[model samples]
Target chain A: MWKEWPLVAFTIAGQMAVGFFLVAGFPLFLLDGSHAVGTTREEGLAVLAVVLGLLVAAALLSFFHIHHPLRARSSLVNIRTSWLSREIFFELVFIALVAVEIVLVWGVSAASGLSRGVHVAAALAGILFLLSMIRLYMLETLPLWNQAYTPLSFALTALSLGAIAAGFIWGGIFILLSLAFVAAEIVISFLLAPGHGVYRSRPTPSLRPPADVPRYLHPARLASSLAGLSLLGAALIWGRGRAVEGLNGKEWLVAAFALVLAGQLTGRFLFYGLLARPGR
Target chain B: MVTQYGFFFDAAACSGCKACQMACKDRNDLEPGVLWRRVYEVAGGGWEKKGEVWVPSVVAYNVSMACNHCEKPVCGLSCPTKAIWKREDGIVFVDTDACIGCRYCEWACPYTALRFDARTNTVSKCDFCFEAIDAGGAPACVASCPRRALDFGDLAELRKKYGDVRQIFPLPDPSQTEPALVIKPHRDAARAAERAAEVANWEEV
Candidate 1:
């Protein structure tokens, strides 16, 4: 149970941090016809700092899962061949690029126009950071994580969260995009679900008795069901309102978060429970 | 004084620019995806109320890393084919020609730095830019970094420069391996605890 918590916590923290940064940082990138508003260069950079900091925190936390944390540095030696090494390498590079942007924003006296380029660079770095994170889970040995859609799913999740947060902050076309992403996530989740027939063997009966079986499956199944329902809710809200108003954005965000949390937890549980052990 | 090569990474001054990465790639003529060095951005602390002041302090530390080339290297110890070796200068190298493409060294290294080249069927890693160091030029990365975040010189000098300061924080866990690289963490006790908790959670799989 303790072991599972770490994975759960890390996933939650990572997703939340991505959401926080996206919401905090997107307003800076928004152009108002010919002008931009709502974010200063310093604030934009502070958001970058927060995002990079969170990613580093996530990376450092990942080290604990490894048997040897001290030798973690040795992982970098394999950039020539391993995607794992490349992932670490790119994460480091992305962090560095953000640092450069921060320095240029805070330390140097740069023009706002120059700062726009930095924003674009920061966006590119964010993309790299997300890609590196997805690649980290793409080990061929881990069948559940190794699927082609694993990275795609993760990327979509991040983008969905980011778009939702962006919609809340920016409140325009971003809302539509966020709703579309939510709808897409619902379709993906439904497609990805393993039906009862898909199981390689029968599920072990709950030793606690039949009464406990529903209790165990309730959260997972309900969460899965809620994911689809919430997505439909989001589509309805968007179609009727056209433009997000009142609490619409917040409702969509809350719904998306719930669905994603439920889906991810269910997926993680299934990954650990059903996947064949390497030796077995 | 006997001369030895190592890195002098100023944690305080490092802004985590990846020019070092680019420079290393250019100097080594590596393919697009290859990187001999990496920079890690480490941060700590959270918002806490100290009296009337709601202090939300966060500090960023940059770790520009490469092969630590420890006095004792596990990669060398675990390589069944004797492909990995340590030099007198405290640099670790992989003899590609002698490598059997077995990934044992990759698992042996805690740093995950040993890469198995499928095309060459060999293992490879940083050689500390031997040709440039031999010519008295700084390693390509050290020379190219605009911020001077990385400096390569005698290990003793680096120790002396940083010795008086508080020992670096969160040096990789010391149980399974001893890394030559030293880290100077920016955060204090509370932050360390938070980070430790975070790490504990991440290991779950």
Candidate 2:
């Protein structure tokens, strides 16, 4: 049980960081009206600061998941064959790149070429980070995780949340796009679940502990299903009078976020718990 | 000194033709339902009624992705049996003979770039067409990209040519793992933020 805790902690921390970043960061990057709340500089910095903080926390937490955290440097040796090594390398680079971007944003305005370069670098770094994360699962060879959409869904979740965060910050037409992407992500993740046809692959012995047979639903799985439903419902009511009239839209977004967080947590739980030990 | 070989995807010119996907299949002799590379069309942002015209600007970005052959790969780190390893030139490859089919690497990776060949019960991905590269040729996918959207060379050279433009959107939550591919998005950073806000509002509703 203790052995699994590292995985559990890592999963929870990673999911929380991702959730917060998506909900908070997207508005700063994609919203236009956000400038009205505060100066563009202030709002952007707020978003960047949150993103940086969450990333750092997630990185540190990832170490706990490793059996030998001290030898973490050695993991980078196989950049050619392993996605984990690349994931770590890219994450370190992202830290440095985001730092540089923050500096550029402060030293130079949003319009400056330096800031732009940093943004691009950050974006590229983000791609690497996401790919590495997905590859980590792909390398597992678990039938449930070996789907084509695994990585796509992982990346899409981040993109969706980030877009939503940006909508909050900018408060322009971006809100609609962010909502749409969230809806799409809802559909994608649900489809990626184990029972789905796309994810169907060879089966292995049940990893569930013996004797705890209450239909064993993974927490992440339950959360994901709930999140999907809530997000879809939010989409349906988004353009309605209630949404346009008051804080109804904001309330729905909060609810959707809760569901998303639950789903992410569930995913993390399943990620560590459902290991397919060879010859089991 | 470490040298890594990988592919650069130009989303603007991708055209979504999927020639690279086909070329990869033919060259690698992959079985059906298995793809080394996939092209995804990403559309985002919303429409609003402006003064005279309904200004609806949506960003449609196409991503042609495969294994990034990262500088630090998660697959290798998680493999209990040293089945996956990095080539000297920075290409990651799995030795079928050594792989125990544990699937640890698949779980470690964030990109899902690696696939398990059920026939062999092992994993595989783009080898950078190591055979062709050794014979003074490019990977089949790069060679087949008619739009000139894909290129291969020293990582430094490609970065120089691209000039690392700003506002290129990275995969979400990059802090989780480091990936190597770079991008240059045409959209403005401020604009992206606005879109995010809108989504947040919608979700709240």
Q: Which is the leading candidate under DockQ?
A: 2
lDDT of 1 by residue, A120-185 (tens): 665565666566556555543233455654665566566565555455445565556655665665
lDDT of 1 by residue, B64-89 (tens): 66666655566676553455776667
CAPRI docking class of candidate 2 = incorrect
Supply the DockQ value of model 2. 0.03
True contacts kept of each: 0.00, 0.05
Cα-based lDDT at residue A178, candidate 2: 54
Report iRMS values in order: 16.4, 13.2
DockQ of each: 0.01, 0.03
Report the C-alpha displacement of residue A87, candidate 1, in angstroms.
2.0
Winning candidate number (TM-score): 2
The positional error of residue A114 in candidate 2, measured at the CA in angstroms, is 0.7
